[model samples]
Target chain A: MAVSDRSASHLGEAVGLSDEQLIEMYRLVALTRALDERMWVLNRAGRIPFVISGQGHEGAQVAITWPLRKQHDWVAPFYRSIATCLTFGMSPRDILTAQYATANDPSSGGRQMPGHYGSREHNLVSVSSPVATQLLHAIGIALAAKVRGTDQVAMTFMGEGSSNQGDVHEGLNFAAIHKLPFVFVVENNGYAISVPSAKELAVEDVASRAGGYGMPGLVVDGSDVLECYRVATEAVDRARSGGGPTLIEAKVTRLTAHSSDDQQTKYRSEEELASEKARDPLPRFRAQLVDAGILTDHVEQRLGADIKAVVDDATQYAESQPDPDPSTAMRWVYAEEWPSEAPPPWGFGTAGGHAEEH
Target chain B: MPAKTFIEAIREGMADEMRHDGSIIVLGEDVGKKGGVFLATDGLWAEFGDDRVIDTPLTESQIIGTSIGAAINGLRPVAEIQFADFIHPAFNQLVSEAARLRYRSNNGYSCPMVVRAPYGGGVHGALYHSQSVEAFFTHVPGLKVVIPSTPYDAKGLLRSSIRDDDPVLFFEHKKMYRSVRGEVPDGEYAVPLGRAAVTRAGTQLTVIGYGLMAHYALEAAERVADDGISAEVIDLRTLRPLDKESVLDSVRKTGKCLVVYEDNRFGGYGAEVAAIVAEEAFDYLDGPVTRMAGPDVPGVLQPRPRGLVHDQPGEDRRRDPD
Candidate 1:
């Protein structure tokens, strides 16, 4: 399919999501929070080695991804994108398997550390430990879409810290120059590991740099699910319609420390922490749904219990799964086979074992 | 077949592949209009359009990062890093990303890309332009490092590297680019990634080297032939996934080996090759494996005027069985 001729009506009134879609998105966000909390407990109990919680950024991640064409659009998610990945297609079991580093983990097959997520079915490009690299990878995916004449758009998430990376600039410039179907979402959750956003950039907002790349810059209230969804829907529609890339700065809160290893209280004051807590997207979103009568207290209670059960079952199942064999660890280091003769018409089979259709 | 310089051979190799495979793309600083600083990518832009032969920003990270991304997305991207010395900025992409992509993704994705850079000294490039960067990548497990000594090998190895499923670091010596000429076949052909060539046959001692050092080793062998010492010269075209069979066979026949390389003597690529011989063919050795390499110093401080350079390993290619 080529760029759609659909009008602005594609972005309907009142954030444009049906009740079912809204509830689904809320369920994903709640499940993500539940799983992230379980990971912390597992890490503390010495069951799982590490955990990178996606607690505070869930609202922005879930809202932005809710409008995406799940298996069609590609997502190169950052480490702090549990809610995002879950919203895309990753099941709770798949996520917990990754955290457990089990053989069943589709992302890395238990090879990589927890939080590195990928799946072809979900159209999520695998990422590395290095920050900002995935943005260029996403740009490449978009380039592929542009070259192949497909309507597929690519998006990647990054922390405010990764905005300072050189790859980020290159990715943005390349995407703008090529007019590729892409979107860059900077989830500005204040601090990157320990360094604050003030130290990361001179500008007040990360979106301010978009003008230099000749793309539209957007600043969204990340805590407001409807606001993030509206901005993301517009960006997605624009990108899918051959309108090129858009830089969206999602001003979210980092409710938890950077990871299980970090301590926010050391850097952030009690007053600052309390203020951020008051604006926590989870409870705020729940309250909004309740006041609107879209969600009752009974539904909220049942949903919470259901999400908790799902997270608990996933953690137990993942823990029960076998770890990857150390002897077979060297399997994927090199491709299964190099082209002994001439490669096929597309050169795709020369690597990655599978032969994909052109 | 036609006689071609090392640069022309590389260009021809990439061009031939580009003609055969539509997915192959080239990008780097000035790789499009300028045809690369070394002219290795000459005429590629005119032959292919701007889309295929991309002129990228001077940012090394972008060049490599994009290449890795493109490769993973089904493009065979050969990214040029202008000079080997200027490749540190792209090191993370090459090492942590490109090299590890196939493995880390459990073969779900692969980086079938080539990172070609001009390396070595002798043309007075000094610091930023002159360097032997093979040692840094040789330690990396997933990377295949190729350094060819002749036009024939340069063309063949580069073509194979572009076709290989793994990420290959093709380091063409700057000294050999224009100066080194040899017969390169016109039709498609490729020298495999893990094989070494016995450039010169001899029975006395085996001399091993790669890139320009291998060329110099042949010259040294010719000079030593007059004194009745038949030094078997072996050119290690690919540094990693080393041609252990060729190295062992030559060492077994000659009973001694002397490795020569332009990289610093300490922790050089030559050291690993020397150690391979010591470990695998130790029983067949007649004497200790010796290495004649550049001293452990920065490129700027090295003596100039080529031959006047005091620590030139090409001058030290003698057999010492003791």
Candidate 2:
């Protein structure tokens, strides 16, 4: 369990992962990348509204979620967590439906902007557009878990830039104080929108802030899935054992610009972008599987083809799904028959005539 | 029925609900041991213990944010923001997370939480302590803003808000907490949301108001009754999805409307009431829809005479047609 930096080793074997599970991880990473690519095309062709790619971070996103119990554990994900959501059981069609803003979108039914993920079936909490707000939500759910005396642990992910938000500090401090079962993971991709990590964080490691809340802080190389899986497993175990929260910073690389409208050329230098591309986790992880003899060029070709087919099918299915009816705009604002006391002249008589006995 | 103060009514209502429903919890600064700044949550910590009546850190965002999470996880959380003015720190949590949780999640999740804060400016508590923030929350579509003027209404409305499916911003007027008293029902009951109560009935002019202004409107109705002017007072219990039918009916009967609020006159909740009346009941109106509200300035910081900061709705009734 030595933390190796970007080098391929037999660490995946040491983690006791089966060959099928490891390959599935690679497939998910590739599928997430391919789906993100499809979204860019859809956005460019005016078929979709927006696209926020999780490029170069899929390895960390999917790997860190390996040790958790899907549909039992809770995840409060940030916008760029497509791979993580996929690992948590969000269908590809769900992501595509959200991208197309169709009626069948599992998360929001075309209500919110793309990249916002939510799925109750998988225990994934609704993620809003505001940065770092998920940290507090994760803590709150964990608080519920603690109050109920359950071993369920909730995890939240944020960007390096979000670490500077007041919510991150307040949530982490509150979680630590209550000894809540939670994990705060920071995907340090070296940039927040256009601001670099240097400007966003005063300390070198985002995990260093964990000490302020009396939590264990660990930094893992985001490109190495094995290292992230190992750390995430430990953090989850510690939280379930009543050890409180742990702050883990996965140092990752962002291959693409922030969103569809952003252009890295404006703020990020070409050399820096090129260097990050060279260390892209997709190819690096693929190389690791190849060196481990678990994957050959032929298996890689088949996985790539299968992922492309899945993405294509999802794109076509979501694109054909009908858009939400404009008349249903006020559907979820309140529950059905809510504000139970209807305005007068339309009701039996007075406003309180039929007050519910609850 | 028990005659109780507005704050006592609130505490009793929540305690009663918590007794029946194990999921209901109160969390905020001083909500536990200190029993809240104004004791609005008095005896709750002792009854429900620290777990149910939590004492959170002195941060508005943490209280609101955590409440949203708790609400989503099968718990009905009532978060108390110390004062209305201090709610700004949690604006993002309310508007983004709590308010929109249901709509964004497409009914997959809902934040059934109530954020209770004391509002209004009568005790000369100054800018930060005494301010009305209902106008800001009323503009958000997914949120329900409730202001109860009497002890009875406070208990009923708060109980109803706790059972509501959407996020509710309950603004308890600071001046009315102890000053306003009435008989609250002893048995289980809830005042339904999205309805207005006609506190005082009349026929000449319909005076629509909420919170402290509603009390002032009732006084104005009584004073105008001394004259030949029959002033009908409508207490708007819920601000959003505003009991429009009640308002339009009152306006149609009275043929005139006067909307009153404690917030600033410019871009205040009263303006919306006036606009709705003007748009829907314009043909029935005998005169223009008048509005009585606080001046369009930041809340007063210095000590002032009895009613300098807030509008005197009863005095404004003097301008009624002779």
**TM-score, chain B only, every model?**
0.94, 0.95
Tens-digit lDDT string for candidate 1 (B105-207): 7777888899999887766577766788899999987888999888888888988899998899999887777766799989878888777889899998999
For lDDT, the strongest prediction is: 2
Candidate 2 lDDT score relative to the true structure: 0.85
lDDT of 2 by residue, A1-358 (tens): 1112233336455886766777888899989999999999999999988889899899999998878889888899989999999999998999999888899898999998998989988989988988999888888888888776767899999898988999987888899988888998999999888998888778899888899889999999999987888899999999999999999999999999999999989998988888888768888888888888767677778888888889999999998999999877756666655453442222435556432111
* Highest TM-score model number: 2
Q: How close to the true structure is residue A117 of candidate 1, measured as C-alpha lDDT?
A: 90
Superposed by TM-score, candidate 1 places the C-alpha of residue A321 at a distance from the truth, in angstroms, of 0.3
Fnat per candidate: 0.54, 0.63
Off by over 4 Å in 2: A1-10, A297-301, A338-358, B307-322
Error of 2 at A341 (Å): 16
Per-residue lDDT of model 1, residues A188-283, tens digit only: 988887888888789999999999999999999898888999899999999999999999999999888888888878999899988888767888
TM-score of each: 0.91, 0.93
For candidate 1, the lDDT comes to: 0.83
